[model samples]
Target: MAVTLKAEKREDLNKSVTKQIRESGYVPSVVYGKDKESKTISVNSIELVKTVRDEGINAIMSLDIEGEQPVNVMLYDYQKDPLRDELLHADFYMVNMAEEMDVEVPLHLEGEAQGAKDGGVLQQPLYQLQVRSKPADIPEAITVDVTKLEIGDTITVADLPEAAEYEFLDTEDTTIATVVPPDTVSETDEASDEDAEPELVGADGKDEE
Candidate 1:
């Protein structure tokens, strides 16, 4: 179910007006979509933050605009105050339920890798996955199990399990995770120390041959 968020249309584009809106605990936002005229609006800051916190960033929203029919939207982008870390502005994109869209979904790794347990370093190269699916079919996240991975083994995009709901956009050769042998810096340092010659010291604390 889409979360409902109330919004009010704003006609004034004055800088002072935008400042006042922020001061009044509202975030100035714009709603837009293909083939539709963009609308400027304002939403309650507290409610907007709470909604996004409860729902993932990709959660569909029912934007209830005053004097207009409610529309389905997704939070497209946002800006925050660099110093205060407060939300300053937001952008919502209206989405068609039947139309396919490209989005980035969070990627999660589950289970400890066998290679890591055996002293190998496990690395995740990709933290998010590009996926294409309809609005209703979009997944909250994609998880890959790493329990079977061995040293020098890699999990690529092609290694992922097939899903009917969404399609991965990344090329099959793109690596997601891998396990490799641990760094040998300590062994190299030990060898270097063993090969070094001790320097003779003089009474003045200077190196002498």
Candidate 2:
């Protein structure tokens, strides 16, 4: 869900002044991105938190700043007050809805794995992969079926049900998740001896314990 916010100008950029601003119940934030200059504005802390908590990190927000046209942006990062547990600051990234957006969507696996019932371990190597699509076409998450996965059966990135219009940012050969025997040997052996071991141990003797 997209959100909208109204911001006010702040003349003070000093720490002491910004601290005073926070104490009064306002959150100072900035919107940063590729082409546009960074702009600083203050918003209602309670309202800002409510919008973010209700929506999501990827939610596009229409920011209404004085003397400037309303700009739509996505929340990229934020800083919080650990002690007070309050919103300290936030950063919004400018999003171009018309262009393809690369995002990582959540992964949800359904049903009990047949292999898992017979002492097979279901390992989800990668829960999410970076995908490219327009904002309106963005999917909340990808669903994977584990019901038919039997021992020794492997699932690769290509097995995922990808929308025709979207492009997966990951390589086609990338492994997503898999169900295998409890022994955990075939994949482990191939990954370790052939490719993974050398990369995992650059010089350190960090073999499997």
Best model number under TM-score = 1
Candidate 1 lDDT by residue in tens digits, 1-209: 89999999999989999989999999999999999899999999999999988887788999999999999999999988766777889999999999999999999999999999999878898999999999988888898999999999999999998889889999999999998888743565699999999976774432210
State the C-alpha lDDT per candidate: 0.91, 0.77
TM-score of each: 0.85, 0.74
lDDT of 2 by residue, 10-80 (tens): 77799998888898998888876778888888888987888867765556788878887887787777777
Please list all clashing residue pairs in model 2, or write none if there are none. none
Error of 1 at 148 (Å): 1.7
Please report how far candidate 2 places residue 83 from its true position, in Å: 6.1
Which has the greatest lDDT? Answer: 1
C-alpha RMSD of candidate 2 = 7.1
lDDT of 1 at 36: 89
